[model samples]
Target: MQGVDTVLNVLGSVCLLLWGVRMVRTGLTRAFGATLRRAISACARNRFTAFAGGVGLTGILQSSTATALLLASFASRGLIPLSIALAVMLGANVGTTLTAQVLSFNLGWVSPFMIAVGVIAFLSNSSDKARHLGRVAIGLGLMLLSLHLLEAAAAPLRASPAFVAVLSGLQDEYVLAVVFAAAATWFVHSSLSSVLLVMSFASSGIIEPKLGLALIIGANIGGAIAPYFDQSTTDVDARRVPLGNLITRVVIGAGLLCFLGPIHHWLAFIDPAPARLLVNFHTAFSLVAAIVFLPLNDPLAALCRRLVPSRPQADDPGRPRHLDPNVLDTPAEALACAMRETLNLGDKVADMLRQTMDALENNDARAVKAIEAADDAVDHLYEAIKLYLVQTSRNELGEEDGRRYVEILTFTTNLEHVGDIIDKNLMELATKKIKNRYSFSAEGTAELRAFHARVLENLRLALNVFTTRDITLARRLVAEKTSMREAEMHAGDSHFARLREGRPESIETSSIHMDVIRDLKRINGHLTTVAYPILEAAGELAETRLKPSDQTLMRAPAGS
Candidate 1:
């Protein structure tokens, strides 16, 4: 009964500790999300800066996995390179060790005091900054309290003859110790938790010093598996970093085993006490691995490239399947990638609109065939982006990303609608014109072609705005919307005036001409729809009425 109670108490403490870590991480990320992103994006120019950025971000968030995942997302988006990502991943490993070091100290008494202050601040009508700080304090306190409880639970096990014998059974065999530690850590799904448990056992003399050291090594290996599993759903390029990490650990573990006798002798010299020796060994292994690998990052990346050869025609012009699942772990980068895909969708729709319009004006069957093919391509992209966004939104995302995900979904739907409007409305109209052998007068064909060119140009500009988030392009697009509307009205009036003049060709083609103008106007309206969100994303449209400027309208003609 006592043993069961002890185990339950330890389990409860671990649960509390995990909860506290989560709270602190969430609070800190919310407080500094934008600042951190700006800092990382600005400072990560070289390998060294990227490494430092990774360490700094992970140290602040207290989660190496979170930092590495963010870097991976950046790499996928072409914002960061694979070599820089490797450096960052190495730094993240060092940053995560800070948590263990903090827990090693005797800070149990401060836990309740931190919780009290945290609660008071949370309850008070304080500023957001103060509340955020309070949350951090509370998380730290809970973590310490949990560590204290974990230590206490293992205290009695030191005297248990059965526990000591179990430890003795695995002490000398390095392979067995590695397997046991890996199994235990894997089952827990937390390297930190497994390390803490090893520390508890070592501190209480329930596990031998050598066995504890082996467990620490095994925990590192096991912890790496989590990240690797995360990469499984991502692109093949994304799998390289985690695979590198796994290979590094396996090779290092093997080296440690080969030189165990000398390693133990050196460890004894550094820390005479067994429990301290175990902790020191864990720290030393990480430090040594980092130092040895840091300088060889470029070569390591090259090796990964060679091992995982790039696919032939990977960049062929089509829908990209590179929205790796590993990227979903970082919401900002995921949102950015989604936006890129949306822009690609816009481009496809624009192509279809242009081809369909050309077919209608020229009565060309080839143009209709081209538009139909483009429509199929646009449909595929739309489905891909919708599915990707659905999967991405399920992960932990910032407020802006959450909103952007919805916006991307909306934008894709609008682009898809534009495609449908072309195929069903414009394409069908063109087919009818061809079937009837209806020929427009030269003047009418020229005017309709001019209008088609303007709408297509506007669609292209809207796509650029979406892709680049360019405020300048966005503003210009808004201004062009007015010109487009004017053009539609002028075209309508001219078509009616020609009919009133009793021109035989104009009267014969009056209905088709009116339909083409209306559809062109609608297509331009959807093109404008893509731009408003771009302005909103750039924060230029927030509570600001931006009227079209005359100078903006005179910048360029359609297709220029």
Candidate 2:
């Protein structure tokens, strides 16, 4: 019963450690995420500054994996050079050891006071940023508190036969112990939590000093593994950063394994406290990794590039370039990626619109064929965007983020439908005109050309509105919808007048000319739909265009 209780108590402590670490990470990220991200990005001007930036960010957040993931996203976007990004990952490994170093201190007394102050500030503060900082304080307190609890939980192991036997097994099976810790860290996705537990175990005499060092080495290796797994679906540039970090860990971790015997002997003679032994090893290992790998970043990065050579995507523009899966954990970044991809998709549709018009004017079969080809690319992007968005954590998104998500999805869907209209309807119209060699009458040609120009102008405006989300421009787009309707009506009337005058070409092609006019108007209508959500969100859209029913009910004043 005592053994079972001891195991349960240790398990609970582990959970508390993880929760506290999570609170710190999420709180810090929520509070200063954007500024910190920019700092890292800007530091990429040089490999050394980039390295410092990684260390600084992970030192604050206490998670090097998070740093790696953020850098991976920047690399995926082509914003940061791959070499600089890999250097950041090297520094992140060193930064992660900060937690282990801090935990090694006897700061348990700080926990209760910090928790009290944190709760007071968190509850009293009105600003989200302040609250997030308060949350960070609370997480720090809990981490300290959990370490205290972990010390107490291991107390029972002092007398338990089962615990002693387990420790003995670990002594003989040190390699297996390393593997176990590595696997556990990978499962939890946190090396800090795992290493701290090993430190706690060693502090309480539940594990040998040599065993503790082995586990810490494993924790480092496992920590790098999770980020690599996360970036599996991203582009080679993104994957390469994590891959380079993993290689550093593997090489260093392997070397550390052989030296553990001698290091343990030397450290035990120098300062024999088991907890310090475990944590100091972790810190030393990481710092060495940073120092050794920092200078080799270029060669390492070159090697990574060679390993994960860029698959030339010149032919696959439809493939999503901005949707780095690593950043999906950061909702705002992911949404921004989706928005950029939408703009790219919109550009494809714009190309189609221009091509179709050129095909009409020049009687160019190739231009019409280009429109058809571009539509397929548009369809590819739409599916990729949908699937990419579906991967985002819906429940985690904020209110504005949720709204933006729907807007992006709706905009992409509308763009896809627009692509269909161009390929299926407009292409057929162009094909018919060219195959039958039915040229429009001069008056008819002039009207169709004018209508096509207006529609194309609106298409350009809609793209700007989608990208900038300028409510005034969106308002302009909505207003122009009515004007476009008026113009379409006028053009239709003009076509009939030409037909009724017994103009032979107009009479002969009356059906085709009117159909072309109707289709262009339809395209303009589709372009206008992009503005509806923007207007509705801004509270500028009226429920009905009709005057209030009360005006009708009361009747005009008798004076009128």
Candidate 3:
């Protein structure tokens, strides 16, 4: 009965520890995700900088698994190269050990104060970033408290003869010990928690220091496994970083496991406390692995690529390329995926619009068919992005992420509207012109062509505005909406003048010409909608564009 209670308590403590680690990782990701992504990407120009970036980021994030998953997201999207990503993983491994080193110390005294402060800040602060930081502090406090509880829960087991015998058996079976720890860490999805658990057991004398060292090695190796399996994409590029990082850990961990006897003897001279010895060994092993592996990243990356060769996939522009399901838990990353997919949606619509002018001017039936067929792809991409954004919204999002989610959803919806206009309205007009072999006046053709060009440029700008959310670019995009309206009107007046001059081409194609310009203006209106959210967010948008009247009519009596 006592043993059962002990087991339950230990399990609960372990669960708390894992939850705390997750909270910290998620809070930091929510508050600083884009900045973290930009920082890592900026370092991609050089291997050393990339390595440093990984170390710093993982140190702040405190989870190599989190770092590994993030890099995998980037690699799958082709945002970061495989070799640079490998370098970052190496640094991340070292960074996580830094966390273990800090947690290994007795910091239980600070836990309550941190938790109180965190709770107060979380409840009091209105700013999203501050609230996230409070969550981080609370997570940290929970971690420290869990460590203390784990030690107490585990202390009782040290006195049990059966438990002692089981731990004693592991001292000789080093391979089993390492394998067990590796499996536990992999299952937990956190090496920090595993290492801390091992530290707690070693401090309680439930396991020999030498055995704890082997367990820590296994934990590090297992840390790499979760990310390798967590990648949602089948793209060979996306899987390379985690696989390469895993191989690196396995290689280093296997070698270290074999030399555990000598490593333990050497580390005993530094600090012989069982817990400290295991912690020191974990730190040293991570540092040594980073030093040895950093320079070999290129060759190692090549090896990973060779191991996981890219399978040829048919290029389907309609398919969602970057909506990786693995990142959906991280709203910032998931939003990025949706944004990329949305941009692809925009590209498809732009292609359709660009082809309309050529098809109408040449009376090319095949081009019109092609444009019509391409709209199906546009619809597919739009639906994919819309669904992806909906899934991302299910997660807890900060203000910034929530707004970006809406921005992405709104822009993709608008892109779909633009696609429909190009397909249903404009394509129908083209078919009519083509079937009748009608041609516009030379001047009218030039005018419509020029108008199409302007709309095309605005399409590009809208996409840029969606991506950058730059206020200046967004303002310009809105301004172009007015320009397009004026151009449509000008084209209308000019077509009427051509009819007055007795131009036969104008007389025959006047309706189609006017309809085409009207549809272009409609498309422009949809594209300009992308800029509205951006301007509104910055407080640059007016509630309505209507001017106030100088006089108002009185309301009539109800019946009258």
TM-score leader: 2
In the order shown, the candidates' Cα RMSDs to the true structure are 8.5, 3.7, 5.3
> What are the per-residue Cα lDDT tens digits for candidate 3 across 472-538?
9999999998888888888899999999999999999999999999998998999899888888878
Instruction: Find the 10 residues in a row with the least total lDDT in model 1.
Output: 321-330
Task: State the lDDT at 437 in candidate 3.
Answer: 87
Better of 1 and 3 by lDDT: 3
Residue 426, candidate 3: Cα error in Å is 3.7
Regions more than 4 Å wrong, model 1: 1-12, 23-58, 73-88, 116-135, 152-173, 183-190, 259-275, 295-299, 316-341, 363-373, 376-409, 431-438, 457-514, 525-560
Q: Which one wins by TM-score: 1 or 3?
A: 3
Write the residue-wise lDDT of candidate 2 on 464-559 in tens digits. 998888999999999988998898889888988987888987876777788777888888888898899899988989999986697676796776
Clashing pairs in 1: none
Cα lDDT of all candidates, in order?
A: 0.75, 0.84, 0.88
Tens-digit per-residue lDDT, 256-275, candidate 1: 76766677789899866665
Q: Model 2 Cα displacement at 543 (Å)?
A: 4.0
Q: Among these predicted structures, which one has the highest lDDT?
A: 3
| Residue range with the least summed lDDT across 10 consecutive positions in model 2 | 321-330
Could you tell me the C-alpha RMSD of candidate 1 in Å? 8.5
